[model samples]
Structure formats: C-alpha cells, structure tokens
Target: MSRPEPLQPVYQFSSAQEPVSLRQGTVEVDFNNDRFCGMADLVLRFLPGPRLVFHAIVRSTSEPELPFFLNVPDNLSVSFNGQKMEGFRGRWKANGNTLEFDWIPRSQPVVLSDMQPKNSVAAIFHLFNFPEFRGGNYQEVAPLGCALLVLESEDWKISLQELPEDATREAWDQIKNEGGCFLTHMVKMERKDGEQFSGEDAQEQCFLLDNFLSFINGGRCWPVCGVGLDASGETTWETFASPRPVRPPYSWFNPYKASQAELLFPLFAKRWQQSAEWRDCLHSAIYWYVQANTSGGSPSIDAAIILAQAALERLAHHYLVVDQKVVSGKGRASDRLRMLFSACGIPNEIMDATPDIRRANGTFKKDTRWMDAPHAITDIRNSLVHPVSKKKLHDCHVDAWKLSLWYLELSVLALCGYDGTYVSRLTAKYVTDSANVPWGKKA
Candidate 1:
C-alpha cells in the first residue's frame, strides 16, 4: 500500500541551535575569525553590563604575555579587571591587521578580567540561559557566541511611574544621537590543529543573532518583560534570555511555504507613501486587526467592528479610489466594495468563502444573497459605529467576522499578488475550520 502524504502547515516557527555553556549562562554566538593556521582555544564570558571576559588558550613557544590590540571604535576603553588601558599603547601592538594582547593577569594562570565599554558606550552580548549550564566548560565546545543588550545607562530600567515623558524622550534620543550603540563585538580563537573544518554550524546562529538584534535595536524590546515564572507568582529583575531558534526545524509535515505579502505591499507603500489620506487610514485599519485579535467586550466589539470597517475602507480605497483616481461620490460602503471587488477581486481558489463579490456584480444586488451580504455588513458596521437598538443583524456571528477579516486578507492578498497554496491554506484554516459550515469539512 502507498503511504499517505503529510498535511501542510501555513507557517512554521523558527528553532535555534542548542546552547553551549558560557560560564554559568549559555550563549549563541560565532567566534571563528580569519583563521590563520594554529590552535587558538578561547572561552568567553559576559559579566552583566559592559564587562566581557575572554579566556584564550593557545599552545606556548612565544613571549610570556602579548598585548591584544583591537581596532575598536574610539569611545571604548579596555581594562584588565579594574585598571584601564589606553587604546593605542606600546605593549599592546595596535599596528598592522592584528590586535595582540595578553588577557592573563600578572601572577595568576586563571585570567579573570574584563573588556569594558567607555562612558558614552553601552554593550550587550548574546548569552542564552535556559536549563543551567553544566557538564564541562565552554572550552570543549566547537561554537562561540555571546550577549547583546540595549544601550543607555539603565534607561531601559526607568520607573515609568516617575519619569516625565519629555525626560524619557530625551534619554532615548541621546542614546542614539551620541553614537553610544556601537559598543559590541566578539573575539574568536580556533585551535589550528584541533580538527580543521569549515565553520558551517555557526553560520545560522550568527544570522539569527543579527536578525533579532536588528529588530531590538529598532526599538522593539518590550520594557519590563516577564522573564520567569514562579509558582508563587513572584518576579525577578534579571532580563534572562532563553534558548530561541531563528526558524523551526524543517519536517516533512511542512511541504513548502512563502509569504504572499512580498508581492503587493511594496506597491501599496510606494504609491501611498506621501498621501496622508491613504497612509494614516491604512495604519488605523491594520491596528484594528490587532484590537479585534486581542480585545473583546460589548463596547469594545463595537469599537473593533468600527475600526475594522475603517481599515477595510482604507485598504479598499488603495485600489478603488486611489488606483482609479476618483472620488467617493456616493461614499457608500457598498459603493466602495463594488469598486474594490471590481478593482481587485478575491483569490480564485478561496472565492467560494466570499460570495459578496457576486452582489457587487449580480443584478439581485441588494437582495439576501451571499453577494448581498455587503449591505447587511455595512448596516451592522453603521449600527456599531452609530448604534441603533432596533436594527437586528442576522449575519453577525463568529464566522461572519472571520469572513470579513478573511475578505480583507483576500483583498490585501490580491493587492499583494498572491494566488497559491497559501490562499487555499488560509481558506482551510479560517473559513473551513468551523464545523457544519458551508465551506467546512462537514459540508
């Protein structure tokens, strides 16, 4: 008998590599720099704030201690534990491509010192700690990685209850303006003889780091995040980062996937970049999707429907009014829908889920056909925004809301240029997932 094919998923979550021990915490970083023929053993540790500790174990037959000169940006000052060192010094050779220096202390073989960022600089490393780091030190590991946190002197830790809005803005702006965010780096030491191999594994880890840190640097970090969960319902101050993969592991269950959004968003953004009538209206609509997904109540439901109506109007306006270069003479929701569907119809595969487009075209226009659902939809939208107690909506339900949103999704998909399995997948999940429905499995 032939084996049945596995089900396809819409999108899979990203998975990351297992963390290697870095002192007490686990880090995900790449540290195999321009490898120049030799075993350069290295152990890196992050000690809160701006302190970075590197333990390089290289085979002997040279000077007792060599100064490591790194061509770091001007604002940073390196130190041996507490005492500071000049960036350009004789003992530490800063000439040529190499930045040679001894991280080891005077009378101690165990070099436990720090490389600190200067006054105007703040640094962070990629130290991911999930289940505590155990079973041998990072000395035995092949991959090298570390931590990277936000800049500014604990500006990420201010009491929102006390700080004024202007002060908060000032602090945030100053961190960026003074060029304080550049203070971050990683030092790689690969043993030249210990099995020379291409550093393939660390490639993904490096990519993941850059991908996430870019978002955070662009002001995406949620201040006061829930770091841990105690059964007693308490919290901790540590901004503890845990293991996170860039993308989920590939499996046969997920056949193939790509974003349909890639094709069309550029068109909308480019065309509407300068027009406030189009721009702000589009934002309001998208934000309503967030509210609809997150908030629910009688009044909130009304607000969501109204905002969703607003968003849908803006998106429809993208192709209809904007593309046609016309005005909303009648300014009716049905008029907009007629123009929108005419301009950008639903994706063919999922067209069965949305029949309202028929009403836009068919002569039985305002009758109770699925095509006529727009009139009812607009009526409900008007009642929600400008309420009337007597007007009942037979179309108002969970699936109806899904249909409206899915219609918006389809319209967006149409604008974005998508007609693929993703459209069918969305149909299956959103439209047909409900039991006993016309498009669902039961039907």
Candidate 2:
C-alpha cells in the first residue's frame, strides 16, 4: 500500500548503553539506558508531608523535542525496595520513554514510617531509549537508561540533609540551663526554586522547632524552683541569710507539725522565693503544669496560662508559709489582708478588709470586693482554659496574667510579714527583662 508507507521511521535504543544514579539518606536508586531505547532529559522532585512522593518527567530527544509516552507491557514492573508496587495503569505508549508516577512506598505518615532503607538512599530513577526500525512495522522499545530522583521531608531539606538528632540535642541543653519551659517554632526550608512554603514565618512554628530540638536533646527535665540567676546576673531569690530580714523563716507555723517549723523555717529563711530566681521552681512549676494539662498534647494558650498560674501559686505558698505574722494570726484578719495588699503595693482599699468589711460609702454592701481581684483572675483563667474566641488574642493577656500572679504571690508574702522588695525583684526579672530573657541555644 503506497510502497508500505515508506516504513515510518522507527528508531530503537537501549538503557544498557547509559546509566544514572542517585542517593538520599540510606536509599539509593540506579538507572540504565538499555531498558528503554530513547534520548530524553529526566527531572525529579521531592515533596514533604504525610507521605514522601517522588515525581519524574522524561522528554525524548527529537527534532522538536517530543514527549515521552509508553504503552507499558504486561512484563514491565515498578517497585520500591524490592517490593513490586500494584495499581499501575500499564497503558502508556512509547512517545519518547517518558513516564510519571508517585513513589510513596505505603499510605502512612511519612515521619512515622521507615521509607528509606538502611544504608541506602531513597530515589526515583527513569530509563530512556529508542526502538530500532523494522521493515514495515514498529515494535515496542525496551527501557534504555534510568535517572534517579530524590525528595526530602521539610525539616530534612532545611537541615541540608542532616538528621534532626543533633539539633534536638543542642536545644535540650539550652532548655535545661534555663527554666523548665521550652518553646520553639517550625522552620521551612529555603527552596532553591525561590518559592515559599506555608507557615514559614509563624512564631509558633519557630517555637515548635525550638521545642522539638529541646526534646531530642534530653533537656526536657529541669529544676523548677530555688535560687538561680536572673537576667541582670543578680540572684533573684532572697535568702534569710541575706542582709534583708524580710527574707524567710517567719513566725507562721504549720499546725500539724509545729515542731517541724524549725526545719521548714530555715528552708524559707535561706532565700526570698522567686519564680525566676530558682531554676528548680520554674522547672517544677512548668513540669507539673504541663504534666497536669499538656503532656503528649499540642500547646494551647489556656494550657500555658494554667501552667503559669500553677507555678505562681507554688511560689506564693512558699512565701506565705515563711511569714511570721500570717502564721500567728496576730493582726485583724482584715488588717492582715491589708498588709498583704500593701506588700504587693496595690492601693485597692478592699484588699485590707475582712469578708464582711463594708464600704465607707455604704452604697455597696456585702463582700463585693473580695470577689473582685480573685474574680478577675478567674476570668483570666477562663480565657486561658477556653481560647476559642472569634477575637484575636494579644500578648497583653499573658502579661496581665503574669502581673496578677505576681501580685497574688506578693500579697501572700506580705500577709506573712515579708517585705515587698521581693515583688519588685520578681517584676524586674520577668517584666523588665522580657525582651532580654535568654533563649536557649539556637536550635
């Protein structure tokens, strides 16, 4: 028929003539040309997410650069780690030996799976070649050569292929040196292609990175209380032994073990309680709060506030127990309460009043004031507990909560007859030094 259509030009090639190799972590892949006969340029890409997916594109070398297509034969097979992958359509034709497919070994969270083989790099390889021309018919061409492709997880990519093991360890050490608190954020890799990924600048993401590194570095456990250094390089915890007599070991005695007052007094007298001063207190408070609320869970604003309040309460109790006047109840309850108010330096007249303390104006009767600060604190607590509000939360809420807790602790200490200086010191350590607070080593 028309001289057999002059035998459409059919060219055959084999991957056996050319070869390519690629490696990532412990996974390795090799490609050879003899398998498919064709000239082609191969491209590979790696993506990060629930599962690792590798994509490949192959273009055949032709006068105008033709697309590679394949009508895959029944004998052809695709596999990962020696295991044949199922569900391939197997309907591609040889346009130029170009093929595309995902190479996810299994359907699972990539972080939790062991996709990379030990001592072998994970990669996707492509083989290309052209088929030889026959008398008057065309025959399917086998694969010629293959090119390897690699894709890495986001963190792996940012770390430049380095595993997270070391960075985590370093972060842990930093957390241990500071208080028990460890915060970090996620960091996205800078793509060579100049594209930005999601959450690249989120502050929480940065915190996540820090915390992850801390956990991996064995810095999870740290002392929460006791004497420690503050931002100013001065000891924040006031010891009874210090020149300040208001420090600790007050007259208040534990009713159950009055005899042990001597033992407990010395502990209190040794130092002014500081949430920031003692690494142990900070550590313990954070640890206890986290254990009580957030262990093995995601972080939330309410959880953070609850943890902070718990820590503050512990510090307040230690200060209160050490004050002499509070233990003996020598002054009027109202007066004692007033002294507590003065200690924190809050001029709220209601602070010194008893539950029945009436207002001089007499317009509002009954202990409404008692419900005020404590109620305000409770409102803050509620906000912390239930953070799901349509309104955006600002950092000021945390600052207010911290200030309130400090005031509460100072008042408790004042009721025990401790001077107010400790409150000032604590404020300086936490509020004024907020910007200068030492972050753990770079994760």
Candidate 3:
C-alpha cells in the first residue's frame, strides 16, 4: 500500500544538505562528524509499532569507547534537516572497522525546538487495530483531567478521526489477513488551558491516556507515532514508539458500535486526579490481564491462570479495603472475591456465567454440590498452587480462567462507576454486539 501522507512534513532527515524522503519503512539519516567517528550513513527503519531501528557500519580508532553514545554534543542538542530533535540513546557493537549501532529512545520524549511559548498543545497519535466509529468518520470522545467542559476544569480533550481511507485500506487489509500492525485509528488531543504547554507535558498526558485506552480497548493501544503541536498548531515534538506486538482480541467497548466512552473516561480522569492507589491498582491489573491473554511460549495455560487469579485477588483487596473501606485486608481469597463482586454488583452464581464455563463448573462437585463462581475459581487456583487440593480437569482449568477474566472485567467497570453499554464475552453474538453493564442503572 502507498504510505499515507503524515500529518505534516514532520520527519525531516537530510544528507548533503538535501532532503531525504522516507519510503518503504527505511531512510538514511546522516550522522554528524564527531571526535571518535566521522559522518556516516545510518539506515533507519520504522516498524509497525512506530518502533525506530538504526544500523550503521563505521570505522573507530584504537581508543576504546562505550558500546554506544549519542553523536550530538552533551547528547541533547541535535538537528536533522534544520528540524530540532531531542536526545535519544544509541547502542552499538565494535567489530574492527565494522561498528553496528541500534538506536532506541530512553524515556526521552522527542521535543522539537520552539521559538516562543505556546498557550495550548495539540497531539496526534496513530493507533493499531482500533475500531472505527459507525455511521461517521469522526467522533468527539472525552476530555482529560475532568468530566464536564462547562466547569472549565478539563485540561485537554480527545477525539477520534478517520485517516485517508482509500490510501490506508490496502495496508489495513494486509494486517487483517496476515499478522501485522497498521495505522488503524487516528487519535487527536487538544489542550484546553491557556498556559504554555511543553512536549514533556504532552508525553505525560499521553501516558495517562494510553493506560485508559488499553483498558477500554482490551488490548495495547500504544501509539505507532505521535506528533505534538504548539498553540499556533505548529509541530513541536514527534516520536516513534515501540508498542506491544499483539493483535487485539474482542474488546469490551467497541467504539464503532456502542461504548461507555463518555461515561467511563471521565470517571478514570477523576480518579487519576484524586487518587494514587487507584492508579497503581489499575496499572497492575491491566498488566496481569494482558500477560494472561498473551499467546506463545511453553505450556503457559497454567501460568496464565495464575496471573488471572493474582489480579483478581489484588483487585479484590483494593476494592474491599482500600477504596470502599468495607472490610479489613485479611480474609480468605474466596471470601474477598465474593465481597468484591458484591460491592461491584456482580452476581455470585455461575448461572449468569458463559455457557461453556457454567457447564464445566457443573462437572466439578464439592461437598456433594457444585461450587459457585468464587469458590470454584479460587478452588481451581488452589489446586494449581497447592499439593493438598484435588486436581481439577484440564477443561475446568481453562473455563475457570475465562470465568475469572469475566469477573475481573466487570469489577473494573463497576469501580469506574460506568453504567453504559459494553460488549460481553458471555452474551455477545458477534464481535460488535454489546449490552448494558449489569450493575448500571440503564441495565
């Protein structure tokens, strides 16, 4: 597919004072003359996650040097084709006259040089496998730091817009057929405040949004590339980032169909402003959940089950003791999980559970009767971790994993105080099917 035009001519690599056009994911970025090494041609490739990779072969003197170092002075000041670039880390290996280099940014978000302060900031982010909105090419989602604009409390706003559809269709189609990443969604952020906004600030805001978007998308929503704009709407920062290499599964909220974006996002922003523990717990839960679902490697089904159980226990502790303050931090895992589910308005029975899971649980009997979700989930997890407990059927273990994941999803949505519709793995007839949250007023 022909590469769609970028938001602007933001990437400016040059050689011999001539502009270099980026094509087919590769470009030659020239190096500046330095004490240890002379100017060399550095081949750069932009991977699917907008990950940057650099390779170069250069001659070095006998003077031993670190594996890699920035070619720029003090590792801060840099310019490519007259466009300012922030400092980034580089790694290399020396093999006589053939020195190989790999460049990856070390938490140093790229900030373009600006002549003067700007009152507002705008940022554009490219998303992988994000669903497009139905019936329209544009949708205004939510703001950061606040719920309502009437209160003038929000610091930034977010919107979803379509890219060049025809130009990008072939690339997206390839991704759908073969396993790869493509620019599937375009996300825009605009600061509402009048104060001067910097690239550093934009990075922080984007990080917060990334976490929220991941939870909503039920997968990693790392930006393939990001472009920051000043008040006058001029480019101020740009960076290609490494995103998790995984295709998204069925997400809870399908922005293309029905979602709780308007309600859920604001609650997240509010919690971000008022609570620190909330932030930590959510991040941990998201990390564990993703790890459980990630494929590949050895017999990871057991490990995945353990991760899901661990997340449930952590969230249960947080919801019962930390946030709600209704119970002490001491209790059986099953009891705590039950309490957490009750507080979230999630049912205790396995009846409402997905048919396969409910059927699998029925096959296992404890005390002459089948256990409920909390008991069955915790029991199976116990069998895995402890030698005294009876081993569960392999099918039961898999179903328990699914049941635990369902509980985890509902608990999070309830914690956010969301009442809007969501796609449920238990009931959805298709990928885009959705229903109201069980605990929500609308339900």
Q: Estimate each model's TM-score.
A: 0.35, 0.23, 0.75
**Residue 41 CA error for candidate 3 (Å)?**
7.5
Provide the lowest-lDDT 10-residue window in model 3. Answer: 144-153
By lDDT: ranked, best first: 3, 1, 2
Q: Against the true structure, whose TM-score is highest? A: 3
Candidate 1: list runs displaced more than 4 Å.
1-256, 259-282, 294-302, 347-371, 389-391, 419-426, 430-443
- The local lDDT score (0 to 100) that residue 45 gets in candidate 1 is 23
Model 1: worst 10 consecutive residues (lDDT sum): 153-162
lDDT, residue 313, model 2: 55
lDDT of every model, 2 decimals: 0.32, 0.28, 0.59
RMSD of 3: 7.7
Q: How do the residues 1-443 of candidate 3 rate in per-residue lDDT, one tens digit apiece?
A: 33323342234421111222221222223343332333333232334334443333444444445544334332533333344434453666555444455444444333334423443367776665554445222223222211111111167666554444332454456556775555554666766654566666666667777777777666667654567676677667665554454566555776555335655776777766666788888888877776665443332767777888898898988878887798898778999999888888888887655565566656656553445678877877877888475544466666677677778778878877777777876667786777877887674
Index of the highest-lDDT prediction: 3
Q: For candidate 2, which ten residues in a row score worst on lDDT? A: 239-248
